[model samples]
Target: MTARTLVMLAVLAIAAGTGWLSRGWFEDAQRLTALEAAQAAASQALARESVIAGVVEARLATLDTHQRVIDRGVIREIQKPIYRRVCLEPDAVRLLNDAAAGRAPDPADAADPLPDDAAAVE
Candidate 1:
């Protein structure tokens, strides 16, 4: 064979080998790009979830404080007036006096209301 023909054959062989190896490299590069894109998407989704969780936590804290204020303020306001009225009733006052004197409550007094007591209840 001529020297030029042998050199041409050698160049063609090297070119074929390079092309075969480079095909796998090109596919790997494409796969790496796809993985990077997927990672970015996942990071964005996590950020959104974190923001939502922060909002929920803040709202829960606000609701908890409001509920505590209602329990302390509104319930106390209602109970104070009701307790005052209860304390002023004749039976309650008598019972409180007897208890202060360390007397046992009269069973008959609790069981049978006087006519005036029944009328006052209405």
Candidate 2:
């Protein structure tokens, strides 16, 4: 063969070999890029879920504090009027005198209702 022809044939052979060897590498690179994109999407979704959870926790804490305030207000309102009624009753003076003398107050003069469990223990 002529020198020129031999060199040309050698070049073509090398080019074909390189292309064959690199075909799998190019396919693997495409798959790796797709995997990276999927991972990034999953990370963003997890971050959004955490933010939603934090907001719900904060709202629940606020509700708990408001409930405590309402409970305290109701207890105060119920107790205040009962104290005022006891103070203004016409028998208040006599009741104080009997208590100071250590005599047992009559059941009819009791300010509060009797317990349902009072007879249960006997």
Best candidate, TM-score: 1
> What does candidate 1's lDDT look like per residue over 22-45, in tens digits?
998999999999999999999999
lDDT of 2 by residue, 11-118 (tens): 999999999889978999999999999999999999999999999999988874433333444444456766666656656666777889998778786676568997
TM-score of each: 0.47, 0.41
Error of 1 at 44 (Å): 0.4
Q: How far off is residue 19 in model 2, in Å?
A: 1.0
After aligning candidate 1 to the native by TM-score, how far in Å is the CA of 55 from where it should be? 0.6
Listed per model in order, the count of residue pairs whose N, CA or C atoms clash below 3 Å is 0, 0
Off by over 4 Å in 1: 65-122
Can you list the residue pairs that collide in candidate 2?
Answer: none
